[model samples]
Target: MRSSPVSRCRMHCYFETGSPMCGGGTRTVFSKRRAGSGVLSPVREGSTLTHGAQKGSISNYEVYLGALVGTLLGAAPAVLADNPIIQTLYSTDPAPYVWNDTVWLFTGHDEPNSDWFTMKDWRLFSSTDMVNWRDWGKMMSVETFSWASADAWAGQVIERNGKFYYYVPVTRKGSSMGIGVGVSDSITGPYKDAIGAPLVANSAIDPTVWIDDDGQAYLYWGNPNLYYIKLNEDMISYSGGINTVDLSSFQGHFEEAPWLYKRDSTYYLAYAGHCCSEDLRYSTAPGPTGPWTYRGQVMPTQGSSFTNHPGIIDYKDGSYLFYHNGALPGGGGFTRSVAVEKFEYGSDGSIPTMDMTTEGAPQIAPLDPYARVEAETIAFSSGLSTEPSSDGGGIHVTSISNGDYIKVKGVGFGDSGAASVSLRVAAANGGAKVELRLGSRTGAVIASCSVDATGGADVWKTISCPLSGSATGQQDLFFNFVGGGDQNLFKFNWWQFARK
Candidate 1:
């Protein structure tokens, strides 16, 4: 007995019998004799033998079983390792912070199809491996602040004494943009207004928070004019009045979006320079607040977005620059998406010019195929969105149309290969097919599973399909969707594979 390819079995068994199994009727026993051996072998008695049969001896039941088994066995996995890490939502003002083993990213949600910066809230996402970002959803919003009337703009979060503090700019009722502080016990927060009033209300914005070596925390933010305040140990209050930074040496246009960080006693102020179409420029200071020396532009004026924001961090021994651009479909200045780049610091602690790219930072490590991966964790996606799942407090891939797909990169299946694939999905309309392809969209289809309606879009049901073929080692995986008409096909929550 030999296992047949999944495609051949699917074509011969499914199309011919209309049943998943060959030789239609329920059977008490099935057997397959080895080719040329002539010895009847019963792998299971009073049970359906769903896999492997002698050539030409495959019954309709066996063919259906073989196809199902192949669908499961050949079920491959995928990963997303491209720029604009979060595909489901448009993110801007990427603020990344390292906590324990994960890089937590906080960003502003750009309203879809907006002509202006009609942002209303902030978003949270995290990733251990840069390739896959876990969407934590809305962490804070304008409604979180009593004094805020509108505009949930660029901000930064820093943990102090187990409490997390977020500094952001929002529109005040009777004034222009003002900075406010939000506090929570955890990094991913349902934070409340730390203070009922604006922290620094002199029309400030784009607050970047950093604590110095001597335990002094500093908040830097402003548009055209840069300002810094020494935050007291309470983190909610400042020791003195806000001090302005002199920008005489910053030669290029100094606009806004200041990212303040220190590396080996060198304090760097990376900001969005120039107006209209801002570029990334930085200056060095001797201390947290300083008479700075300009260090040329870090990134020239480029990318589709007119304005840019910078968020820099060092993770897993690698330096990463997180920024935003109008790169996604229907993206623009008001609908920007966050992106990241890996770079090295000069010996003098200066940042080299970084560029936006579709090929984002390399994966810190290969994805484990045996572990469950969320469907929303995509490298590159088309025609998809995500929402909260009903079964549990988790996210699922949604807004799927025919021909929509997601690509996950560098998925390691190992040498023995996968035995089966299981996907937790739900369909309101049903009749959707998910085709697992390796390497590319038009690549070899390892397995295809038909989705049945699970009553509701959130009603998740696990579907297991047999899989075949050598799905060993590292390879890019693509999940190509197919369904009738233009309606959404199904929602995918998570997927995993069993080892051979």
Candidate 2:
């Protein structure tokens, strides 16, 4: 059967009014574009990395909001994220590719290892914020037509020149099964195969294309002979034709699905070894096709369709891994759901470390709810590097940044003037407003609605003016701060780490 194609945000734009872009006085939002829309304001300086507190490489960090900022005016604190940038998508075999701020996940909506492609269908889901998602519904199915039918497996989606192409893997009744090519002008569409036949049929089951520097592209696929074929400018087929290699050097066992990409000059090939069952063991190689060296196990979630089929993509100067895992919380169906994690590259450029957490890690938080709704928990920078700053007399803030959860506890407050000490913040540039919590040292947040910003993306936010600290010392605060506009650079405020 033919297959289909599939397809963050910067921190820093959360403060409103008096932006440096606006010359630090007063300006409304009409003068600016909304956050995460990929629109950016001309930078107005003030975006340097200022480190006031740092002894060494910092470890971990936290952010929290309790009910205490106001007595008469109380509101709920915003939620923090944990790990696994994206916990799940509608289907598995998740192959994610980034386009603009949106993350496109093309996956198969069928049962895991079902050996049934006839019943299988493919779908596409999109996310602008990586937190909230927009599902386009069932995209293509074996039942969709007559030319192709059944056993849809692992394939890839790539855009070249102008159009999008979907390379689908399937098991034709008589033919052993290879990748068939499909075409669509839009990422989400009712696509039709290119040559009305598989692009490189019978080459390998799982096919993925990696476009390298020098305008050259290579196809990575298969089992015994991990294969490759340079793609033409059209990206419809191979330029130098399909090339196959023996993946013996690398410890690829039962290896099938393959995903490859190049970073700097290093080409990375990540594939699954062993059967993709619940006890699935994942491994990777350094080069696209080579003495593929074996790394440690990537996942062990079990084959409820909860296996590893990684699709690596680069966006906003960072790398992310898109794969699958068992969605059956009850541990039943081989239901595969798409998930993601931030990637860490090693010094020697050896094997990379992927940070996966039940909580969202490697992502900026207090994200726009309208954005892609990902996992709830987030991974924060750890260590006592800095604290939120505060007003000299009331509450003491030590360090501050975007999307951090700080813990506050040292001072006792009078419930009466909650509104006065309610903790307010505004960007040097005019943006938007929101309810910030200046929680009491007691429970969670009491009096709320204090701080507000535009949830600025990559563009950095400098807290030239901040809430004052309490007369008492050591006020506890959770760092849930965010920095940068989606397109700008992400930097934090001056952190008073452990003091001078």
Candidate of highest TM-score: 1
lDDT of 2 by residue, 1-500 (tens): 11211100001111232221112322111111112221212211121211221112221211220111111124453223222222222256777777756778788764433322223667676654454333444556654434455666766787877678777776554656656777788878667767656666653567887666667767766653567787787777676666666555555453556777777766666666553232223344555445555555554433223135777777666666676543212111233445566666567665454423333324332232122221111222222222222322211222233333333222223222222222224243333221123332223442232233435432333332223332222222333433444211122322221111
TM accuracy, model 1:
0.82
| Residue 348 lDDT, candidate 1, scale 0-100 | 82
lDDT of 1 by residue, 1-500 (tens): 00012223223433566532222423213323222232222223233333332112111221333333344446332221265677677789999999988999999998875755678999998888787777777889999998888889988999989999999889898778788999999998879999999998887788999999989999988766778899999988998788987878788567778899999888998988765456788899887877788988887765556578889999999999998866544445566778898999988888998766556788888788799988877767766776767758767777787877887777899988888899998888778999998887778787888899988877779999877555788887888999997647888889998998
Stretches of candidate 2 off by over 4 Å are 1-90, 111-119, 143-145, 239-241, 252-254, 276-297, 300-306, 329-333, 352-356, 365-500
Give TM-scores for every candidate, taking all chains together and pairing residue i with residue i.
0.82, 0.53
Residue-level lDDT for 16 in candidate 2 = 33
lDDT for each candidate structure: 0.74, 0.43
Candidate 2 local lDDT, residue 247: 52
